[model samples]
Target: MWSAHHRRTAILGWLVFVVLATVVGGATGTVTASDDEMGTGDSARATKILDDAGIDEPASELVMVGAKSPDGWRDAAADLSRALDRTGRVTALKEPLPSKDGKEALLRFQIKGKSDDAADQVQPVLDAVDRAKDAGAEHGVTVHQFGDASSEKHLNDLLADDLKKAEFTAVPLALGILLVAFGAVVAALLPVGLALTACVAAFGLLSLASHQLHLFETTFSVMFLMGLAVGVDYCLFYLRRERDERAAGHDAETALRIAAATSGRAVLVSGLTVMVAMAGMFLSGLLLFKGFAIATILVVCVAMLGSVTVLPALLAWLGDRIDAGRIPFLNRRSRKGVHASGSVAGSLLKPVLAKPAFFAVAATALLLALAAPALGMKTEQLGLEKQFGSDAPLSVSFREITAEFPGGPEPALVVAKADDIRSAPARDALRELTRRAGKGAELTVHARQNVAEIAVPLPGSGTGAEAKKALAELRADVRDVRAGTGSAHGPALTAYVGGDLAESEDFTDQLGEGIVPVFLFIAAVTFLLMLVSFRSVVVAVTSIALNLLSVGAAYGVMTAVFQHGWGASLIGSEKVGAIENWMPLFVLVVLFGLSMDYHVFVVSRIREARDRGLGNADAIREGITRTAGAVTGAAVIMVAVFAVFGMLSMQDMQQMGVGLGVAVLLDATVVRMVLLPSLMSLLGERNWHTPRYLRWLPQVSHDEPAPAARPASPTWQHV
Candidate 1:
């Protein structure tokens, strides 16, 4: 309550912190993860060898020229090459290579810089291609371009647009939900304001953090979404509790204290639990997850801090004015409280508590039925066509190019390194690799270096099953050729197959291996945290089980809708046969963490009711009735935000949005309202049973203190 007592200092201090962090973070700028650091297994080794040798691959781009006649296509392609050469942004331009059908030709070149800088430098090359399109207009010729640089540029642009859309949509949608929940404009705005500031502050902190641990391109968007969701939820919980206390006839000052003692403590515990679950991502050992863990944990911590300190301070300062601009009907209804006889929450809880075992069994069955589809869930690294949607220009170009040429756009690279790679044995090994690679492999040797690259054409679109099969065979060929063709003299050559396909395969395998450990880590830590917080073994176990159920159901829903193509057209999603490999673990941890917010908040309220001499049944009913409105509002807000993301064009965002939205909806409604109460009712007093061994653990009370028993000092209590 020191913050409440010094409201000006607290508010000003928070503002200054946000501004400084943003300024400092912006000044430092964010460092992005390099492909070398992102690669795994052999791909990583290959990249490392090249990186160590200071051999950076220039960006490879291709211009595909199509026409009714071969003459027209070749002429158009030549014009494109000359036009590209005139741009002075390209080098090593190659002659037009004819497709098998001879109706199209491909002009290949490298952007004249490090591949890392290609996305930025490829704009001129794209413009040159655009200009050459007109030169081929006569003869019905058409030019399409696709490559590493174009794909990167397109992804970046798409991400930027998604971020903007999220900003404009999520904020207003959250604010609208809060408006309905609070009924007062001022009261509703408070949570939105707090959440936005927390996001701003976390953004700066994440930028600073990125220097030590470089982040993925989408990290900021993820952070923003998480920050808004949790920040708003925490503040909503705190604010609603304060308002409830005030309406219960406590003076403003006393209401603030009680709210802090009860909801503030719950927020703290809930935040800690969320942070622990997010930490599970670190066990995945992927750079992508590491950045996500850092970003989410940072945002939750900032939101938690703001909830306990700045939120309470703001509530204190506002006093009666917090209810300004209240809608007449909603204000009266809000003041009428949640325990009314006609309340929907009460009616729902009545049946739940009446037949605890029956409701519990029914709810569990329902969730299990939803989860059944997950048993057959298949995972793969989605090709760009599926990821960005087939309608995307890049995907369209990819399809056309692959149809015309045996190898689509990207080629598999076989990198070999050793002392004297120019030796006769190395030459023989290279020749064997080319022979095995069949028809379309080209070799390039560095001037004085020991490394050589054989670019082998990949069949089908570079991201499809055909490409993966070809890559696997090529890698096996590398292994076999590596064993037999090495010189007897010094050291044998070390070869690795590396390219986009190789990276995807390695990444998929890495995630597949890491999933079990990550799941166990999250579940174990969550169980321990819930046990310590609730001081009950049953409570902790149930918490984990319920969260897992909800997560499982989410998986099933994603699989049914996305993988099985059941009603996918309704959501504008493509029916890719598999989910993204990174998605399962990422969704698992994120859902587990986010689901804890409702679990902790609702359970804390129930425990508080029970501690006040209510029987298990009555406490479940009472606790659920009192907290249901807020929890439901928070859930709606979360689902709305997630749904906005679901509407995005990117398959990853769409899946995340639907998966998270469905999980949150289920967690808040069926799981919390029906299953949690029914199970606790069945357990009765045993729900609070704690063994003698757990007596040594610290006791954290979330109950509101009685008027006379309340501490006098305006200080926040430590749990």
Candidate 2:
């Protein structure tokens, strides 16, 4: 058990963690020189394409070529160039790069930074392009631009704009919800303060890591916000329990110690669950996922540390000050002078226990109904161009361009190589394949070669079945042609498909395959831990079932809101076919951590009650009642914080935020508050039964000297 001295020691430990984190974080903040040749398949393919096409000049040496035949276009391009010149982020290409075809006019620009950063520099060039649009229209010329800078700029601007709104909405709303739930200024502020500290630490660490590692900027706000939610949520549970114990006549130190031994241990277990679940991302092998895993793990670890150390320390230091502003409007005070038996929480549990079997069955059935839609869930790649508000200028223009000329901006490339570059048979086969591919109304082969690239324009509906089928047919045809040739000299050929759809499909496949193993791993670990801690088979099984229900119900809610487009407009993202591919796995990992927190709290309390000689049924009802209000309060605070993310413009953040928020809310309420207690009540004394072989196992009892049996009275008061 954690004593007052131990609490003080823990506080000192946190101070040490903070000091070390700051120094280590700062030391890693500097960007390091990276080898330009360290690139992936896509990068290599892009390089090969450019080199083969004789456009292999370094991006820094490239410049934008602009024409002034159209009205206002020249002035716009000039103005954008001026802006870029001032920022010095990139060198504006003053001269137009020569076109591969003499018939076409091109505007070429070069960026001095990494390929990723090049997209960040595209905004000014895009603005110039927009300005020149009207001029081009007058002269029957259209401006089309593509480069790393342009894409980066577009994504950066889009994320920045959306994150601005999220900041404005999520923080205030989350705070207000916490304030209402806790009904005390200091108590409400406590979780928020801890969450902010954790998030700030996480952000600094992530940013520093990004200098050396490939960290996605879009996931930063999400990680920060969710970290805040989880931190606050964990603190809320322990603080509420501490307050309850104090009200039950225990001294401050005793109550704090009891809460730590019970809720604190739960916090540790839950945090570990979340950390391990997140660590599963390491299996993905993708740099983005690895970065996300690292960032999430760091945040979870920091939040857990805060929950156990800083939170307890703050409670000890604040003492009575934590209850300074007991808002009469929000406080759920007892109506009569009659003290509710069993820890001031029996009244809430009594109703559910009245019809335990019915409530249990109904809750389970409802969760299953909600989970039904998840079976058919499909994933699609969400791009900034698709997620922007309908009124956004870029979105509108992009839509129009795609509609007018299928795949005008984004085209799928067909890459192939042949041993006999000039062979007539290879030429005939290529032409035949092109002809067959062009027959599909969904796509048009714009360009081709015997040992070269073919630009296949995709349909306007980017992810329609027709597009998928067309790509399939193209692949099949290419395969058939290559198979007929007998010699190794018949052009060693391989096709590399690159596009938003392809990337999305790849991501989705990876996510699906990864989910089962990850969930099983989490469940197995949780089961082993619970079994070890409680030494009860019934307890372990019940915990797993309850956690799954919580996750299921949360998934249902997410399906309705995100997949069904219930509040798409308010969230600033369009319903783009399906959720992001990795969202489910990410949610599972995160929710496992969060849901386990409540499980530990409830189970620990039940064990405490049982140790006092309470019957199994009585112990469950009493434990649930004592913990319900606190768990519910924590869930609400977490939900509110996550809901703030729903207001973000970025589709990825919106999906993750909504999914995590709903999961925590459902897990706390439907699963923990209702289903868990009812099922335990139905099981009666059998709920705590352990196998005969487990009798020799070590027991994890927090209380000393089990209480003696008392008369069976209607009222069972702790004191």
Candidate 3:
């Protein structure tokens, strides 16, 4: 109220806050998640051992020298080694090893730097490799490079490009949609502008928070994606309600108050619901999820605050000027609620209201059918081959490297700590371990003092089932070796088998264990919040069920398209055969949270109608129709924004984008528009039922007092 009456103060204060937050965040900078923090299980323990021993694992790279004939590989390998040596970034160059066919030789080397900085520092080395490639091409010898540094560099570039594209594409796309939704340039710009500023402020604040939480590199991208979505959504809801009130012939002040009392209340409830859902990630037991939760929650809070405070103030200051620069036909349609009066929602609602049971049963059955595929859903971490697509240069290089020398790109490491790794007993244990690895596998050991690292080249493509089997066998072998060497009750040497595959597997297991608890936490809290807010057990239970259906349907779609290869070609996405391990849990939390925005807004509107003199069916119809345009606009904007991510090169991101986009689309139309109203109609008065025990819960209402009787306006001009 104060913000609306003192518009100038509110506006200037918001600008100052944004600027200061940005400056402070820039000063604090961000801390990336450390390797130990990112690791899990034995992999994490292995990393801790290595770090404690002051052992630094430099970034390793490999160059495959392939020739038409055997003798050519040695010369090409020699030249590439010299070229790499001249770059000064190369260290510990290993002897060129021959492939099984003897026609390919692999030149292995490490980049001279901290492994984390290797991606940024490897450009000079890559330039040298590129030159080597050009020279080798003249000799009819193919030289391809694949390794941690090169692949990470390429992946980082792809991520940056994708985010930039999304930033440019999503913003204008949102603006254009809002323009159509509002039918006026100024009104359309308001939401977009507020959303953008909120994202900026949240970005700065999150950066500062990163110093304490250790955020992932993708945290900012996720924050921006979510911020723009919810930011615009909240503002759209508030502005539309205020405009509707004015169009109903209330003076500007009354219109603003009604909007604040109604949509403003919905925004608050919805934002809290979203934050609660996002907090479910804290139960995931992974630093990554914790960081993601903080990022999302921060942006939502900032956006929600902006919606309730500055947005109302801006509307008050603009008054009728908010509707200036109106487009002709668009303005007329918006004024007449053309989106609802004869629209699809209206058309569906008629039959749905008339035959509520039939429509309700049918919608429920269809959604359940769609959700069936999720029963077989499987998740795995995407390797370079799948993440960057098979045709990408880095993927091609990795495939070539793995083909020439299996598991050469990423070998499993067995870290053993003993009294003295150089002692005869330790040496025997290590030798026995290698012998048990069998004939086709090659093993090497690097030992210093009491710490030793044994590298085993796993069979088959890295990250494939074969490699996983190899890792498991190696781990078992180490345990046996430790037991054989033990003279006391415990094993003489402490050992951990760790590598990229181990890390991925361990992380996947962690998520698997966390899923049930996290889901239960989110569902329980959301149900409680809804029940208390709506003062109805039926509304709470049904809302949870409907959201679960939406999430399940989205999961089923992702499984079919990404894993089962159903309709994969239609969208230009590949059948990666498994969803990204983190995607399911991440999507569950995000979708459950985001879908509530529309769910709460629509339900609140419906409850408002019911609070008035309207009957259940009438209230359902009125609520769905009246809020159709805004909900559709919000859903479309979210879907469009997420769809931009679906076009990204990374399969995991594609899954996330598709999963979220599909869920929002389903929620807004099928679930929110059809199933919800039909179900409510069938339930009738039971929709608002609360048990006697729960009746003591405080009454929370988004309903505003009936508008006072006033002189009717000649036309809808006050808006």
Clash count, predicted structure 2: 16
Question: What TM-score does candidate 1 reach?
Answer: 0.96
The reply for model 2, stretches above 4 Å from the true place, is 1-16, 30-114, 130-151, 164-169, 181-183, 207-213, 324-348, 416-452, 477-487, 490-494, 567-574, 693-697, 702-719
Write down the lDDT of every candidate, Cα atoms only: 0.87, 0.65, 0.87
Model 2 per-residue lDDT tens digits across residues 1-719: 33233456666776676666667777776343221222224424533544464432334322223344423234444554565565555554564333333223333346665554556555555565566566556655455554445645666776787677776676677677667766667877888877877877776677677766666565676577668777887887788778777877876666777778778877887788778777777665455566778788889889987888778777876778886777676544421111332344576567788888888898899888877767666666655465555556556655544453454354454555555545765566566656765743232221333345555666665556767776566667666766765465465444444445555555566666767777787788778778877887887888888777767766766676677776666656555667776677777767776677778878788888888999877888767877767676677767777777776666677788778777777777678777888988887777667789888878777452333344243222221
lDDT of 3 by residue, 450-519 (tens): 7777777778776888988888888888888877778553337777888888888889999999999999
* C-alpha RMSD in Å of predicted model 2 compared with the true structure: 7.5
Q: What is the clash count of model 3?
A: 0
For candidate 1, lDDT tens digit of each residue in 1-719?
87887787899999999999899999999999999888789998888888988899988887789889656677677767777888898998888888777788888888888899888999988888777776667568988888888888888889999999999999999988877777789999999999999999999999999999999998998899899999999999899888888778898878988888888888998899889889988888789999999999999999999999889888878888899999988766666644452177889998888888999999999999999989999887676667899888788888887788767677899998877788877777878888998887998887488898899888877777788889999999999988985556445778999988898899989998888898999999999989988899999999989999999999999999999988888888878888888888888998898888888888999999888889888888888888888898899999999999999988888888999999999999999999999999999888999999898888878678766454455442210
- Ten consecutive residues with minimal summed lDDT in candidate 3? 710-719
Single out the weakest 10-residue window by summed lDDT for candidate 2: 333-342
Better of 2 and 3 by lDDT: 3
- Model 3 regions more than 4 Å off: 337-344, 423-428, 439-449, 482-491, 706-719
In lDDT terms, how accurate is model 3? 0.87
Whole-model alpha-carbon lDDT for candidate 2: 0.65
